[model samples]
Target: MSDVILLAPHDDVAVATRDLVPGESVTTGDGESDGNPTVVVVRDRVPRGHKVALRDLPLGSEVRKYGQVIGRTTRPVPAGSQVHVHNLEMPRMPDVPGASDAASDYAYATEHRELPVPEGERPTFLGYRRADGRVGTRNYVAIVTSVNCSASTARFVADQFRGRALAQFPHVDGVVALTHGSGCGLVPTSEGGRTLLRTLRGYAAHPNVGGVLVLGLGCEMLQVDALVAEAGIPADTLVRRLVIQETGGIRATVRAAVAEIEAMLPELDARRREVCDVSDLVLGLNCGGSDGYSGITANPALGVASDLLVAYGARSVLAETPEVYGAEHLLTRRAVSPEVGRRLIDRIAWWREYAAAGGGTLDNNPSPGNKAGGLTTILEKSLGAVAKAGSADLAAVYQYAEPIDTPGLGFMDTPGYDPVSVTGLVAGGATVVVFTTGRGSVLGCKPSPSIKVATNTAMYLRMHEDMDLNAGRIVDGTASLAEVGREIFDLVLAVASGRETVSEELDLGQDEFQPWLLGTVT
Candidate 1:
């Protein structure tokens, strides 16, 4: 067996499957024929999951990985040397001709293909069906705060329901306090305010939330009454409201909020899970702490699961706009319409400008953790990140926290930050979130369950308690990609049918309710 894995014929580098020492030899194809293999002697220590030079690279030449340009060589590199940040740097975004023409110049929908209809009976899962025709995987009573000032009181109220408080109410999934940092100190009509409101509304009206308690400080820019009215929450949803000032103080507000939720518990618990079709599922795909094997293993395996769900008429959302910087063109080609393709490009342009204004660039990715895991450039990271969307056509593009009503596959514009990205996905109505991590990121979402998949076997073995599944079995040669993907697909349904993920059992969702704060704080 080969010591290193070469992803493509034109690739200039291969990933070391395991740690390597100097003087060891590795072999790869000569790019002309598989029969004539080329041998290269190891020149330096290559850590497992890091890239190794497949051929001698001259300075200023492009470094190809996954058959795409990841970066440029800073200096001459001999074959078998470890390729990383010290020798490679991100290249500037290519200025494609007719980029000024925007969406029209791209061949939109050229690669669009429809999923074949299944012949047998479609799959089904047990879920809580809401009055609005939406299906939920969990039933929870939510304590939603309107401003930062009321966050503590909301949490205190939710805390009152812990332990044996809900032992009798078997259907209730416990009270969750969805709190954030910004709900005041900004204009209500500004972009930031609007975004905050949208996120709050989405959560309040989410199918998983059977009841909600909207708490506010009364003096904040986001008024409690205005939020409740604008949200258009279904009349059947048991909702209660409280203001800190009107309720006297924190102690008084907590008491009132607790009593309200106590009264709501019986009704919320009365709702029961019923059989629902697979089409009712909205799967959210996100990745963090990525390594070189991420694209080759978990992300692509998750992509296959995403494609399986999309084929069943389910909506699968792929987020983190900045992470897809160098790979937007790939998505554009799979767009179902020119308008959809244009919107994605426009978001990328906005991100470029947004990053510049902050004295940074989109290339400010592949975090330090990513670098240690062998990812050198944002371009390389993005090429791998885009694999999570699979081959599904881009049916729609949505702004942060916007309601995801489209079916098949969609993209939501969000920052590369893990908490913020998953928060947006949950707020946008994802019933279940599948997070692929190469470095073992423990992230969970309230209301929406998060399934963590490890990309490499080492991380999976180290953090087995945190991960729900291991796609690393693919790299271990113990399982095929399709097999692990099908396992993930099966796990999604199981979780939707009321199985608890590791994150859910660990109670890691409450602190992750972050809203994307845009515009200005002041």
Candidate 2:
């Protein structure tokens, strides 16, 4: 094979698929060794899976990939030099949400979700119907304690609702023990502390929630009444708050909380689900423990599936901003407008500063698991990560924990932490999720269902119980990416309509409801 490889024909740079030895005679395109075309070795070592400027590009010129500019070059670069952090810069764009002129980007899709599925369509699942008319694949009630001092009581109360003992409340999903370390040790007026309280309140009032009984130590930074007032949920929502100090300490609090929850069991058990459209579904596209085949098999499959959901008017979300460093140009071109594209570029730039302020580089990603999976750099990993967005036109992008109401393919700003990222998506209104993994992340989001797709067969078999579908078959040469994509699309509809994912099956969303903490408190 030739030493140089162009990713996209109209792009400005080519990435080295393998190491280029010193003075090795190689052609830029096809393997024809011409007498003279153009040649330059700008470095003693050009690592595999790194980018090499395809031509001698001058400083301040745009570095194009996926036929769009990813960033700008800071200094003149040689034809074969590696383009990276030292010389490349992610541009700054403002954070204002700009309006985009509506246009059709789905002309290629002849089939819409409104079209009838052919005969033998088996898209069905048993789901729960909330009071607000939203359907849930899993039914869960959370014993949310607003204070760390009452955490033990919350856990003790949740224990009563576990396993087969929960059969009496058949309509109620699983019960969760939601507690945290922050209701103390900080100023009650602090934004950081207040944001945490709002996050906890949001969880208490989430639509998937059947009922919530808040426990408090009565003197924490986040008081139960404050959480209740901030959440603004109606008393008829089967939610209640109890204070340990007011209830005469821990034992009294647990007894009083259990009595309060048990009182609503009969009412909550009366709720039922009806047929709902796939459009009611908001799906989060995520990847973790990724490998080489993640981009090839699972990620692309998820992307294709995401497009299918968008066709049906379903909301599909892509997150992990840091993971998508190098391959952002593709998304920028697909942005709903130049303004939306600029906002995304700006976020990328801000993250670069954020990383540097803490003494790190934006390229310091691609964890050991990613490396073991044959991904050599952030660029390589991001190229694969972008596939989860599929072929849909980029619709909207939101910051971490911000409300996401717009449908179609959307991007949410979030860190690369699997649990935290998924939490933001669920909070932003994704009722179901499709998570792709090559390295086997045992991630599960209950209440809002999660479907895990494995990149390769080995990891799938090793973590079968945690994983729901096997996209690895595509990499094994037994199935095509489209086939798996179709399967995932069907599964999304099933889960949306009422089927349970493995994580939901295991009552696994108990500890995953965490909010993204942004900026330090003064």
Candidate 3:
């Protein structure tokens, strides 16, 4: 196997496939210099998954990878030296061209490939059909709290289903308390409060939820009545409402909530899963704990699956706004229309101002874990992160937690924080999420299953119990990108059919329903 992998012929750096020793001769090919490859001795020890300078670089020169400018050289560096944070620097934001200039590269997907699964033989999964004609991958009874004050009572209500309490209700996937830290303590009419209210309403009306019991502390800013009204709970909908102030206390509210769920269970349990078309699926894409190989392995593999889904007329949501800072140009250019592309650019501009106000910048990413795994600048990280969207034409752009009403690949504006970003996706009606990670991210989203895909073989083996699939095989040369992508697409069908993911089996989703909190706490 090759010791290093060259992503592009024009790339000034190559990724070390294994740990490289100093003073060792490294082989090169493909005419990177003088139309003929030449050997270059290593100047420093390069760790596995790190980059090696293919040639000497001068100060302030752009460092290229994935055929794009990832960073600039901080100082002159010798060929074969380890290229990382110490020698690399982020590009000036002002120097980066706006998405408007990128519109020239924008083109709708004109080459239509044959469907992966034949039209007549398209795949189907067993899912719960809701009264509104929507299908759900899971049958969850959600106890939603309107404010932090009612969180404990909500938890107490869900705790009634601990262990095999719902064993008789085979169709029920267990009750979950969707609680959060912010709901009150702010102006109820403010934009932040409204966003939070919308998030709660989305969960209540989500198809995956078989029944909903909205619990609230009546005095809070987000009123129970307004929430129920906004959720549009039909007269026949299986939903109940309780307020701590109205019920006399926390214990009473908990008791009422438990009784309400029990009353709703027999019918909720009787709802059986039936075959549903692939178009009924809405998949959310996310990545965290990423490394240098993430773009080459798991991310692009997931992108293929995204493309397949888009081809089938299903919707896929790619989120993590801050994470995709430097890569917005790619998506904007692929947008189905100029307006759609402009919408995406607007969101990027919003993030820019938001970060600046907080005395921070977009380049403040590639967390310590990412740096340790060989990633340097946000540009490099963003370039890899956007691969999860596949090559599908951008269908639309939505605000954080806004309902996803499109039928193809769409982008949702969200933070880079894993749980918070996914929370927005789930609220937008994503029934399943495929999360790719290089350093291992153990995450789950209630009402939506999260399938973790590991980007490296070693991390996959070490955390096999936590990861749901291994895309690392592509890096190992055991499988091709398309092959592993098909594997992931199939797993989505299986997991949507009720196969629990590693995180789900470990019971990790309940606490992860964190709505993106905006504005001041006061």
* Count of clashes, each model: 0, 3, 0
The local distance difference test score of model 1 is: 0.90
How good is model 2 by TM-score?
A: 0.76
Question: Model 3 Cα RMSD, Å?
Answer: 2.5
Q: State the local distance difference test value for candidate 2.
A: 0.72
Sort order, TM-score high to low: 1, 3, 2
How do the residues 1-522 of candidate 1 rate in per-residue lDDT, one tens digit apiece? 357877877688988889988999988755423556767799999998999997899998899998999999999999989999999999877543333445554567679778875678899999988888889899989888999999999899988888888999999988999989988999989989998999999899888888999999999999998788868576668999999999999999988888898899888888888999999999999999999889999998999899989999999999999999898889999999888888888888788778877998889898999999999999999999999998899999999989889999999999999999988888899999999999889998998999999999999999999999989888788999899998999999999999999999987799999999987777
Candidates' lDDT values, in order?
0.90, 0.72, 0.87
- Model 2 has how many clashing residue pairs? 3
- Answer with 1 or 2, whichever has the higher lDDT: 1
Deviating ranges (above 4 Å) for candidate 1: 29-35, 95-106
**Which structure among the candidates has the greatest lDDT?**
1
Q: Tens-digit lDDT track for model 3 on 1-522? A: 567777777788988777899988876565363556656788898988899998899999899998899999999988988999999999887722455554454443333333354456888899987777777899999888889999999998889997889999988898999999987887767879888988898899887898899889998988888888867543335888999999989888777888899999998888888999998899999999999889889999999998888888899999999988888878877887778888887777778778878998889998999998999999999999999999888888999888888999999998999999999999888999999999998989998999999999999999999999999889788999999998999999999999999988888899999998887887
lDDT of 2 by residue, 1-522 (tens): 345545455566654545666555434563223423344564535555345666778998887654556567889976766676567765543332322211122122222233233355333444555555555554567777776788788889988878897687777777788776667776666656755665676667666777888788988767887877757443446777888888898888888888887887888778776666666677888999887667767999999888877777667889999998766667877877766676677677777777877998777777877765555557767888999988887778887655556778889888898988888777666778889998888787655778889887777899898898999777456888899999998888777666678888777876776666654533
RMSD of each: 1.8, 6.8, 2.5
Give the better candidate number (1 or 2) by TM-score: 1
Candidate 3 deviant stretches above 4 angstroms: 28-38, 95-120, 233-236
